[model samples]
Target chain A: MALRFALMIDPLAADQTAPDLATTFTAVDPAAPALTVGELSTQRGDGIFESIGVVGGHPQEVEAHLERLVHSARLCDLPEPNVAQWRAAVAIAASECGEGEGVVKLILSRGVEHGPTPTAWATAATAADFSLARTEGIRVVTLDRGYAIDAPARAPWLLLGAKTLSYAVNMAALREAHRRDADDAVFLSSDGFVLEAPTASLILQRGDTFITPAPNGAILHGTTQLSLFEHLAARGFETAYETIPVDELRRADAAWLVSSVRLAAPIRQLDGADLTVDAEFTASLNDYLLSPRD
Target chain B: MALRFALMIDPLAADQTAPDLATTFTAVDPAAPALTVGELSTQRGDGIFESIGVVGGHPQEVEAHLERLVHSARLCDLPEPNVAQWRAAVAIAASECGEGEGVVKLILSRGVEHGPTPTAWATAATAADFSLARTEGIRVVTLDRGYAIDAPARAPWLLLGAKTLSYAVNMAALREAHRRDADDAVFLSSDGFVLEAPTASLILQRGDTFITPAPNGAILHGTTQLSLFEHLAARGFETAYETIPVDELRRADAAWLVSSVRLAAPIRQLDGADLTVDAEFTASLNDYLLSPRD
Candidate 1:
């Protein structure tokens, strides 16, 4: 229960008297709460975040997560985050977690209402074990995402590419999946293109090629998925980025949901029909995904 | 700057020792902040909210706002809010604002990440003046909302009709409008059907009929629009709800963005082209809208 939390407020703001990262991180109490109601993130969900896995006090894919967070901030029109501040905060949080394994959340918000600058924070907590999901795989159902594949190009205001904090709909989709006695959900575009899972990126294999939906401004640029593709390419495995049809999932030889925390979880069932899952291949992908990148 | 704020935690939660309405209301410091970091609202945008106009310490259209809140809660799968508690809190917050007009925001969130019950609060601040928007009117640009008009029926996970706190996209749309030198935005569905504005409902007059986009599950139910329709009916004006095309807006007699606080602000221009305005009719409608409903 000894979770680590640290907040970094705008130093230039006259009313903010909180200590800087060095002292604050060192003195953070495990039981103390770290947010205020006036924050734009809490009030309007106007922010961006990254959830990086922490192993043995080191953040996994720190650079990749930071790059994605910055990209997300740009999409939301947020001020550029202080990368050094985020790095320091994450290191402190991860170290304080003193870990076998944990989850480090990097949150950069649009600051308080009408206040100048942004609010940044890092929190470290025990990571949820996904051993069963990795080995036994997951059952998923398809749900309409209510938008066409070209939505991102047609509407930038949609903020489709950003990994924003406005994830209520995503969470609701997962809840709906659970309500239907399923483990997860695969969202399909209104025009019948496979999009992604509620919390993870979709990966499907037809033969030797590991395929995923192209970024196309419709999906978040998945760091974990990108890392896996790089590893697969180096090992002479074919990979692709394309507009995947929902029917392609049914015809797929294997499918998986890939993310930072869960790594690669194969699809055991699509809808109610059992799909052929390559357990050995899935185990190999997890090994590549979980391995620390230089 | 003396704004009134109060927090309400579930009484059944043993850890929450905060006093109920009476003592908490009397002791509230206007300057004190009312939220903490653990709240799911700030973290995940998992909540619903209502903003009611308080005129001379009396909340306008209380029943309508509360009823809408209930509907929104049902959509988000949140527990039934304690209506009596909300009423008491609103009364206290309103009373604390003296005889001046103010804005009262009622927020009900999914509570803390690990906590059991929901978190609810009401905050009252001086109302923002919209005299210019009311008299001079506003210029609007149409933006694609990235979903088809019938999307809500096909996808409940979209939370289309619910006024949840996950309004980053809405806020972004407004910002995009401002960037284009427009005062507001009227969101169009991907299929080019007129929907509604980010924060307000659209009402346009065609011939003798007051036509607004029907609540086809793609837009939030507008309390102000509903109240106006009732008042219009009483005054012998014809009203109708139907699927509105963007082209129809160009041919309309007059259009307005109606909301609780702003009341009714006429649209003077659509995408830079000046539109006809019935100032006399708009003023008359505002009179009806501002009048207390039984």
Candidate 2:
């Protein structure tokens, strides 16, 4: 299949192509068809993706997201995406968001069968409101991720480190959480150690210090959590990365699931057991998360 | 996004819409843009699919594939497909393949974000040549599937048995096998039990009895393996399904990775060690596989 996105950028009226490639991405209609029937993105889910939270038309943590995108590309053996082209695409996507909290998804597929180029695109959509989730916090259920903590190291092919488009398991875990009457889920490794949420990273407050599971190949290294840790460090609260046991979670004074779009949402209850939700502390964290980052 | 496939089947002209949905599916151009960028299939890999082997214009194991399709939908919570429509689509897909072996892939995606209906279609393509693999047999390596055999039953949301399109790990395992200088890979459960292949089923011939892993919700129920077992039983060979351990494979007199498209390819070697490859027996199995079946 020919690159439909490439055709959208090539020889045609500047109006048809939308002015200039330097200033604009291929103008796309959300209601129009964009990918071929054989694109691997849809066919095999052989692709990598990132969802950047855009606030007030300003994309957050672009560098970190782009770095992780490159890392995911390496892990998946997908061709490294051209950072300049993607940055431009992300700009185009951010412009489409207009204002307020939005999410811009950057996707890089292995492309159609035997096609010359990878299918790359950015889509911007309005973010779902997580005001209640951020304030009142969220109820979470812990589910087994079905892999040992060291599995990713032993079996790199499992792709535990990559942020791939093959997120059916992640989506299913959320559904399972809802079935258990909780709003979200935190995944545990098969050998009974804490991991992260399907779409987010986990950070727990133990007395005074904050701790998250170490980035040991079994989990996607959390960009938001890193930035939050930096912010916490600046505020004189100790932060660390550790191998968290399942029991350590219960001992946590407070917990939060941190992500790009929803920011920091405190865990009000985990498995029907109440956790200390410091409303004031969580608001401070959210406020910091909402702040402009370069 | 609008249903582009539906648009292909809708009115402007009968030539445009094709003959009839009852007899013919919407005539599709394989290279054309058929899916929107927002589709959950591409976005989250949230979909179910089946690839049926078609030989001499006859689709093999139609009822079994359709039954599995329904089983997958139930596990994934997707809308139960209209069987009659899918059967007609399959016939149309099968017709697209002329005189040789071909593959018709049926995909039912969760559709575009907020779309009213699921996006469904079938695409017909020429099968890859597996002559060398089928005749000389293939070298196989074992990789950990990262889940215990009982994990599927314990966690229904893991979608262990469902034939979903989130096959990144499956694709990755094959890459790992190739890197290790092997042609294919067999998945072993983390708790030391034989699972299936990334895209095929495993059958071991221990002495006179042919055995496959039991369908205990851990591995997929292979349609091709089941057909082959039935054929073997008819030939007066004993056939059984049992919980095969990883050790039992090495002790087996012979083994084969069976699937649609590729059919039956015997295991010539396991992790560089030679296994007994019975050329005449494998050829007979392929002959049965290639025979016209409703």
Candidate number achieving the greatest DockQ relative to the actual structure = 1
Give the Cα-based TM-score of candidate 1 against the true structure. 0.93
Model 1: how far residue A138 lies from native, Å: 0.5
User: Cα RMSD (Å) per model?
Assistant: 3.3, 4.9
Residue B33's lDDT within candidate 1 is 42
Residue pairs whose backbone atoms clash in candidate 1: A35-B37, A42-B42
Separate DockQ for every predicted complex: 0.55, 0.49
In model 2, the clashing pairs are none
Report how far residue A30 has shifted in candidate 2, in Å: 1.7
Q: Which digits, one per residue and each the tens of the lDDT, describe model 1 over residues A1-294?
A: 224564553423322233454553333333454454556787788788898877677778888898898899899998776666666667777776565667788777887665545776667777777889999999999999999999999899999999888888998999999998899999999999999998899999988899999999999988889888998899898999999999988999989999888889999999999988788888998877666663
- The TM-scores of all predictions, comma-separated, are 0.93, 0.93
Cα error, candidate 2, residue B270 (Å): 0.7
**Cα displacement (Å) at residue B263, model 1:** 1.2
Q: What is each predicted model's overall lDDT from 0 to 1?
A: 0.81, 0.85
